[model samples]
Target: MSQLISIPESYESLNLTHINIAHHPPQSPTATPIVILRLNRPDKNNAFTPQMGESLEQAYRLFHLDARVKVIVLTGAGRMFCAGSDLDIGFDDRVERAGDFRDTGGRVALAMHRCSKPTIAALQGSAVGVGMTMTLPAAIRICHEKSKYGFVFTRRGLTIESCASFFLPRLIGMSKAMALITTGGVYPGLSKYFGELFTEVLAEGTAVLPRALEIAREMAENVSPLASYMSRALMWQGPTSPEGAHLLESKVFHHMAGQSDYKEGVNSFLEKRKANFLCDPYEMSPGDYPWWSEVDIRVGPKASKSKL
Candidate 1:
């Protein structure tokens, strides 16, 4: 049975116009915070709008800057997660030149990608086009077994957006990614073409968000925020060679070993108690923490500067 999802009395709300930001406190005082970012346009199947995209990007940037937030859960408000872009509203007509235009969906994806906090996507129902691509940056995705998903851009005679081309292949494999884009067809959450895209699939749509929250709460309580973020970054940007990987790992370990979290981890292990890790990895990163070069998706290459 799908359980009721009630926000505890202690939770705080940001009450943003396009999206809802809920600040969920941890069970223990020492644990890190969890934030839920939900798409609020339930009336339109939570259709993607320029305002919604801006709100999402803002929330992600806030999460990146705030040390209090450890985990983020992305979900939609109603029966359908999102039915892709709000086609009636159409694309932004503000741009004067095509060369200067930047995709809002891509900007949202970039924000999510840049954020260090681990994100979990709770897909309670079908998600199409930009809706599907937005969740690609999340570390984990939990979905309803009956919920459908689609790339859908080709069917609409539109190209893919939201950095899907890069993340999709790396996540599911090149062949599967190619298939999804080529056909632009809707498929169930458990479809063979999707492979292992969803980390967990629950039978009930109502159960999906709750299951994601359960996992997020567990992570907030037991996992080190710093370690989790770094581990993800390492996997996504690690060196290809064995020797390079070994050297990089050694360097990172040496730096981390001197931090407060390492001592707390060791002492807690020895004392048979839960660890109270308080280190902020972003603030205390190694001199060369982000070894790879970063691309600025916001601007053209000629005008862009390296993030690293």
Candidate 2:
């Protein structure tokens, strides 16, 4: 039961009606903010429908925009994580008006990719199809030791969606990505090929979320929010070359030095205390935080120009 909560002016533009948002307060006396965005369709193991995709995209948008939120933990409710796309609904009807609207999960994936917050995906159970790919955008993935993951697109007679082609190879290498996709097999977190993807695997499903929240709390309480956001943006941008990344890094470094939080960050270390980061991303990031070209992470293929 997610209550309609008030948003800071910076985040007022987006609606939060769809997702279950759990605001977990700081554990220590002065820790930073933490929020959990749970995929709520538990009866079906939180299988994602078109409506869920819309809600997920919107929820991610809200999380990124909210200055008060420092870290985000994305997981499903109950025993399972996500079971992937739901087949029961009629989603094809909108494709005529929307055009090539087949990839609903891609929208949510794109939204998550654009978010600057440090994200943790807590996979309490098996994650199949889009369930597995959707989490690739998140920086950290924590799964239970018993949890299984599948890239079952080929087996299902469906093409891969949610930009897995772009992210999977980068994460596990092209050869591994090809082998796994071709096999259309499900592997546990402990499996050699897929082990690298998980940050850590806990003993049971119940421990996954708690451990993830613990990690989020650690980063939120001690890290500089502005630096985290900017650096995270750079990491995911995938610039053209090493020189391009270097340019982005240097620009962000210079930009951060000018902010007031820089002084506070230094002073807090000297004073032997936790630095209170007041500089929201909306307020402090450089002129071009999203320096990457729009073409890079946008969902769907480039539109073909109609020859008049």
Choose the strongest candidate by TM-score: 1
TM-score of each: 0.88, 0.85
lDDT values, one for every candidate: 0.84, 0.79
Question: Model 1 Cα displacement at 94 (Å)?
Answer: 4.0
Ten contiguous residues minimizing lDDT sum, candidate 1: 4-13
Model 1 C-alpha lDDT per residue in residues 256-279, reported as the tens digit of each score: 888888888888889998888787
Error of 2 at 25 (Å): 3.2
Looking at candidate 1, what is the lDDT of residue 268? 88
Q: Quote the lDDT for 113 in model 1.
A: 83
Stretches off by above 4 angstroms in model 1 are: 1-15, 25-32, 298-308
Per-residue lDDT over 1-308 for candidate 2, one digit per residue giving the tens place of the 0 to 100 score? 95564444433233443347666763323222787788888888888888888878877776776777889899998877998887787344464445545477888888888776778999988899988999998889999887888899899887788999988888878888887789889988887777478889888889899999999988888888788878777766757799987877888899999987899899999999988888888677789756755764433667679876
